[model samples]
Structure formats: structure tokens, C-alpha cells
Target: MVTRDDFTEERIKKLEKNLLKVRKENRVKEIANKMHEVLSGKIISVDMNPCYLNDLSYMIKKNLELVREALKKNVSDEGSTSNVP
Candidate 1:
């Protein structure tokens, strides 16, 4: 019972949904890349500043906590996607 226009519309909707999913994945990758750069810079600073060792440890602990949370969220996202059929 689907007309030509209905089929085209459905195709367009699916394409748009796929595009949105790709964009979201790309954005997540970009954020992770930026986080890596920031973490590297922090490590370099810590290496250069012995006096800031305590601060570096604190920062590292906080960053690790954030990374753990992010990883958990990522795992959940992957799990949900895997369940899709």
C-alpha cells in the first residue's frame, strides 16, 4: 500500500537518522582526541614542575575518575547499539 512518495520519504528519514548517528560518533571521537591532547599536556607540565607533584597527582586522580565515567557511558552506548536489530 506504499506509494512512491511514501517510499522516498521513508528512505530520506532513514538516511537522516544514519547521518545523525555518524555525526554523533564523530563528535564523540573528537572529544576523546581532545581529551588525550589535554592529558598529554598535563603530564608534560607535571614532568617539568617537581613542585607541582601534589597538584599533578590530584589532577590525575580527577582525570581518571572522569575517564572512568566516560568509559562506562561509552560501554553502555555500545551495549545498547549491539542490542538493536
Candidate 2:
């Protein structure tokens, strides 16, 4: 019983959903890349001593955790706002 208009509408909705998914993926990648750049710079500046290397390792791990949490919060916030009627 579906008409051409109905099919077109469904197609458009699917495309919109895909677009949103792709945009979110791109956003996550951008955040990760920025984080990588910052971490690389920090790593390069650190001294080669064992103590400094250990500290840098810890900092990298902590920063990665923070980035994950931030990205999760961001994605959740975006989902909540984007789905508004």
C-alpha cells in the first residue's frame, strides 16, 4: 500500500541517519587525532630518564582515559540533543 512519496521519505530518513552516524564517527576521529598530537608533543619534550619516562607513561594513560570519558559524554550529549522532536 506504500506510495512513491512514502518510499522517498523512507529513503531520505535512512540517508539522514547514515549521515549522522558518519558525522559522529568523524568527530570522534578528529578528537582522537588532536589528542594524539598533544600527547606526541608532550612525549617529545619529556627527558629520557626513567623517572620522567614513567611519569610520561602515567600521564599518557590518564589523559587517554580522560579523552574517552569526554568523548562518551560528548556523544551522549549530541544524541540527546539531536533526537529532539
Candidate 3:
């Protein structure tokens, strides 16, 4: 499995921060797509190291869950407040 610093960690964090700061749903979806891309790449690379297969699966699940929760929160938050100023 890849280390935390190598890929997608920064992208995910940045998108998460931006998700908190922005009210637009489109941006959130875009960021989520970026994350999905990262995950797909990692999964495709899994054959490179059979030893790390379990580790990579666990990390992918964790990260995807985090992204899902954040997106849900953002969606609900938007629903609870004014959409336009």
C-alpha cells in the first residue's frame, strides 16, 4: 500500500476544506470525483504488491467512508440554510 503522503491525501484534505467553505454542490461533486479517481488508481495498482492488498483495501474503505460522510454533511447543511444571498 502507498503511504499517506504519496497521493490523494492532500487532494482529499484540500477538497474537504473547500467543501466546508463553499456552498456549491457542484464543487463538492467535482472534488468527490477527484477522490474517486485517486482511489481507482490505487486499486488498479494493487497487483504491484500482494502483501499490501489488505492494507490498501482497508484504507480505501476508510477514506471513501470519510468522503461520503463529509458529502452528506455538506448536503444537509446546504439544505438547512439560505441558498442565495
Candidate 4:
């Protein structure tokens, strides 16, 4: 009972859905790359010094906060394109 036009329409719909999926995947990869770039750094020496420990802890917390903000911004930017859960 399927006509040629119907078949073509179905194919087009499938392709559009696939394109959207690919776009969403690309967006995720972009976000991940940005996060990696933000977090990448030289390895620091570890010692028993309390000051060093405090500085390391602060750096980690700051990096995590930056990542969170970046993710939030990305999610908001893509709000119309995809649903972020």
C-alpha cells in the first residue's frame, strides 16, 4: 500500500533524524574537547607540605567549577537543538 512518494518521504525523514543525531554527537565531542583544553596542565610535584596540598586542592576545585560553568553554557547554547538531561 506504500506509494513511491511515501517511500521517499520516509527516507528523507530517516535521514533528517540521523543528521540530528550526528549533530548532537558532534556537539558533545566539542564540549568534551573544550573541557579537556580547560583542564589540561603540567603535572605538579607532590610533597608533604600543607601549603602545597592547599594549593593543589584549590586548583582542582577551581578547575571543576570552570568545567561546570562551561557545561552549563554549552547546554544553554544548544537548548533549542537538543535536550540535555
Candidate 5:
């Protein structure tokens, strides 16, 4: 079960802000909804340490890149054609 203690208030607030933006604009809302529906999402798992904010920049950058890649893939039809299996 997920609890409030499991997430930071700042993180929750940021999610709320994103949701607000999603609700406010048609294009953004559509894209946000699509990203949520598709295999594109952020994974912000904070550390238990109280002073871990300084270490979050790398994680934030990684997640941002994922979001960007997802956007590019979503906007284009020229996708991967084969699996390297």
C-alpha cells in the first residue's frame, strides 16, 4: 500500500502542477494523457536520506531525457522496425 510518507510533499506538489497544466491546455493535456496512456512516464523514487536533494540532478536529467525521447517517438511515425534478438 502507498502512503503519504512514501512520497515527498514537493514531489506531490510537482505532480499536481503537472496535472493542472494537463487540465489547463488542450494540446498539453492531450500529450500528457497520451504519455500517461503510453509506455512513457517518470519514475521519481526519492532516497530515504533527508539530504538527498543534491543527488537528484542526475536522476532528474535521466527522467527528462526519457520524457524527451518519448515525445520524439510519439510525434514521429518513423519508429524502430526490428528487435535485436
Candidate 6:
């Protein structure tokens, strides 16, 4: 014994699920684009002084890791907010 309301509710839920999937994909795409830009625009020189090169290389790696983590946290936060009661 199903009513029109039941069908509508199911459809809404399915659409919401699909929307969330799309949002997550878009976020990943945006992060990848930003990462590509950062790598392309900020080139490191191989002939740089050894002392400075090592330190700078470590810093750049750390910064990129931080950026990736921040982006992940942002996506998680957005998803959580959407589920608020």
C-alpha cells in the first residue's frame, strides 16, 4: 500500500545522495587543480645551495601535506554541516 508521498520521498533521498557524490567529486577536482597550480608555479632549483635547498625542500613538502589535509578537513566539515539536525 504505497502512496504518492512515499515515491516522492524516495526520489528526494536518491537525488540528495547523488548530489553529495557530485559535491565530493568536485571538491577533489578543485583540490587537484590547486595542487597542480602550486607545483607548476613554484619550481625548485636543483642547483640551489645544499643547506638552503634541503631546508626549503622539506618546508615545501610539509606545506603541501598541510594543504592536502586542510582541503580534506574542509570537505568533511561541509558534509557534516549538511547533516546538521
> lDDT tens string, model 6, 5-45?
99999999999999999997886565455445557896645
lDDT of 2 by residue, 11-81 (tens): 99999999999997886565556447666673344445675456546656877899899999999989888
Each model's lDDT: 0.72, 0.73, 0.68, 0.71, 0.59, 0.73
Higher-TM-score candidate of 2 and 4: 2
In model 2, which runs have C-alpha deviations exceeding 4 angstroms? 42-63, 66-85
Off by over 4 Å in 3: 1-49
Backbone clashes per model, in order? 0, 0, 0, 0, 0, 0
Candidate 5, residues 1-85, lDDT tens digits: the string is 6567766776889999998887657644444443444335555345534333333444455668998999998767446554457
Positional deviation of 60 in candidate 1, in angstroms?
10
TM-score of 3: 0.44
Residue 22 in model 4: shift from native, Å?
A: 0.5
Q: Tens digits of per-residue lDDT for model 3 on 1-85?
A: 7886856887898989898778556645554564467666733453455534444455568778998999999999999999687
Alpha-carbon runs more than 4 Å astray in model 5: 1-51, 78-85
Q: Write model 1 residue lDDT over 1-85, tens digit each, in one string.
A: 9999999999999999999999978865655554566666733443445544444455557779998999999999888876657
User: After superposing candidate 4, which stretches have Cα over 4 Å from the reference?
Assistant: 41-85
The Cα error of candidate 2 at residue 19, in Å, is 0.2
Error of 2 at 46 (Å): 22
